[model samples]
Target: MRETVYIFLKAPVAGRVKTRLGAVVGMGRAAALFRIMTDWTIAEAQKGSWETVLAVDPPAAAHKRARFWPPRFRRVAQGPGDLGARMARIFRTAPPGPVVIIGADAPGLRARHLREAFKRLRGADAVFGPAADGGFWLIGLARRRAAPDLFDSVRWSSEHTLADTLKTLPESFDVRMLETLRDVDEAADLETAMFRGRR
Candidate 1:
């Protein structure tokens, strides 16, 4: 089956990206760090044998002309909505096949992790890579059928985010969970990632 991996990213502009981390590090430094992390994440994700799609926030047209991102992958705008709505839109509109979505700030993410998620999707209707913070680092759908409204009413960025999302799915839906990974959000997270030699 065809597979597409979507990396959600914001334009790497100061004061726009990694704001939480910026609170500890300067905004300019945070943005610069984010740029590096984003590049590393994209490179690692591309190592997998799947088509890569970049889902940019703040509109695709605005960044399409921007030279920050590489020209190798396809790009699309993550149109209007909250995190859930935007993610659901990707699963809803993507071509028929398994689709895996991940954030650009997860420095610990690797090609093997993506391969594992796709592998699990073969048996499960949906798969989630749990984050240490109770959120999720990755979400994948087998897409053997139409995508479900699994993101409604979910408290994004909160500890209950993953659990809330799970509750929205049908009881019969077969779900799989992947290894816990930490996503860079604050200074502490960055410190941990660096200490772990992941970044």
Candidate 2:
């Protein structure tokens, strides 16, 4: 069976997607940028061999109904809960093989990161792509490291997130880290991502 890569996305509705970048770029523009980033990430992920699923908020994804979607992508709405809870549910219900979850905000992420994470999953219990903002841009779990506390008590948007997450895991657990990338969260991050895209 093919492995599943879950891409998490917020509704591309203006003011709903990029609330952090809302101050710098108006909510409408933030939403637009988010849509573009989502498209780019989805397109890049599609080039890989694994299966793709768009796990939208409340698990109800409008992307599936989106007229612009390419082929072979499925959509599922997120369930009610905090970020940790939702992620916990996915780790719990995911298929037997490794399941990776990636956020939509990392405009610079690419297929190579996914390939590396899957490769690392062979020897480690879990893999994390740490974001410059202190949170993670991607997470992958093999059968061994599926635990709820992995995401608990994480300072969601702070730089301490990776450290906190690491502390939650058992000492016996073998974790792997990947190249850190800047996530388009605050105003500066958005500017950086936009600048990089222009080059």
Best by lDDT: 1
**What TM-score fits each model?**
0.94, 0.91
lDDT of 1 by residue, 53-89 (tens): 9998788543576577888788888999899999999
For model 2, residues 1-199, the per-residue Cα lDDT tens digits are 3577999878788777778888777999888888888888898788788888877774445444664344467777668887777777877877788888998888889999999998998889989998877788998888665464666776766778788878877778888999988888778886676558646
| CA-lDDT, candidates in order | 0.87, 0.80
Clashes of each: 0, 7
Provide the lowest-lDDT 10-residue window in model 2. Answer: 62-71
Each candidate: RMSD: 1.5, 2.0
lDDT of 1: 0.87
